[model samples]
Target: MESLIAALTLVVVGYIAGSVKIINEGNEGIVERLGQYRRSLKPGLNFVIPVFDTVLVETTREQVLDTDPQQAITRDNVPLTVDAVMYWKILDVQKAYYGVEDLESALTNLVVTALRGEIGQMDLRETVSGRNKINQALLHQLDEATESWGVKIMRVEVQEIAPSKTMLESLELERAAESKRKAAMSETESMVESIQRISRALQGQPNSQAVLQYLVAQKYVEANLKLSESDNSKIIFMDPKALTETIGELISTDQAELGNGNGNNL
Candidate 1:
């Protein structure tokens, strides 16, 4: 009789020990009974039947996952590599355990597939410029799909987009050519403005010939002084026709002034 009592006590102790469950903070356990999902267990102490109940899965409070870069062709038929990361958490442990075989693998694959679809619908420029749009689209798609899986996608971020080396080089060359063309255009415009200013200045001056001759003489003298200071002293030469024209214009001015004086006296 004492032996039977001892055996029954031992069996009860074993069942109690096996039924006791302790879950840490930031984690949840999904319970299964007789090969069917029963209920989810929250953090801290809990209880379950030894042979009739089992923890099918345990889920964390939050999870971060980095996805590999996917090579995809854009709408413009340009191929690019895109990589991203995601933040997620299990809201329903029961669904998380039963809804998907491998949630992490499924989520990663889903993200890659959605990213490819998003990028494929955009041009290369749009894909590069519209990262926010792509992220939003991915979040929407992931949220919808993960609803059944009991995973909530907190955020999705594009880590990087790397174009091919050849494509990058071509884009850089195009930018450089555009900049060079703009610079050349600006210089030509400045030259045109300077020419126009000189033309207007010449037209405004009545003694334009004398003024120009004086400027030329001043430049010649400066050049001569510079040459004298150098080892190679050079004789500055003037065009004979230019000198003759300057002298003729000076004589014509004097004659006109004298004729005006004579007319006043008369």
Candidate 2:
């Protein structure tokens, strides 16, 4: 009789232990009875029918998912490597649990797809510089797509956007060429301006022709010295007299125009 009583007591204790569940804060539990849809369990102590109900607990707090680098191409056909992070949380544990087979995996694939699609619509420059726009676009797109999955996509961040090594080299070369072109243009403008100022200063002077010839000879020598200093430079020989004649012609035309204007004013 005593052995039977102790056995029954042990069975009762086991049943009570199995029925009582303590869920931690920031978490929720889903209870399914007989492998069918059942009510969810809130945080704190909960009770369930022993041996008939099974409980699955998950955190309701926010989660972070860091994706691996994904390869994508821009609208301009520039291949790029991209990666991102996502902040999310389970809003409906039941939906999150049942609406998707693998919630985390699904979210990752979705983010990657969206990333590639968004990047595909922009060029390389836009993709590199428009990170905030990309982030916002991804957030909105992911949030809408994940609504049914019972997950809230709080934020999306693009960590890196790197072009291919070949592309980077090409960009560097292009930039260097552009810089050289601009520098040449600036030098040409400066030379023209200096010539105009010198012409105005020598205008109407009695020895203007001598001054112009001397100035042209000095500039020609200076240019030759600079070209000689550069090992890679190809020195082009020109007649200094031709340059002097050109400047003389310009000065004469300007003086003529000035005299005509003065007569008109009178």
Q: Which pairs clash inside model 2?
A: none
Q: How close is candidate 1 to the true structure, as a TM-score?
A: 0.65
lDDT of 2 by residue, 1-266 (tens): 99999999999999999999999999999998999868999999999998899999999999999999999999999999999999999999999999999999999999999999999999998998999999999999999999998999999999999998898999997997788668757865776567667767777778876876677667767867876896655677777678767777866776777789889999
What C-alpha RMSD separates each model from the true structure?
10.8, 3.8
Residues 171-191, model 1: lDDT tens digits: 897897788568747754764
Cα miss at 250, model 2 (Å)? 5.7
| Candidate 1 collision pairs | none
The residue ranges of model 1 lying beyond 4 angstroms of the native Cα positions read 180-266
- Predictions in order: lDDT: 0.80, 0.89
- Candidate 2 residue 186 C-alpha distance from true site, Å: 2.3
TM-score of each predicted structure versus truth = 0.65, 0.77
Say which candidate scores most in TM-score.
Answer: 2
lDDT of 2 at 2: 100
The TM-score of predicted model 2 comes to 0.77
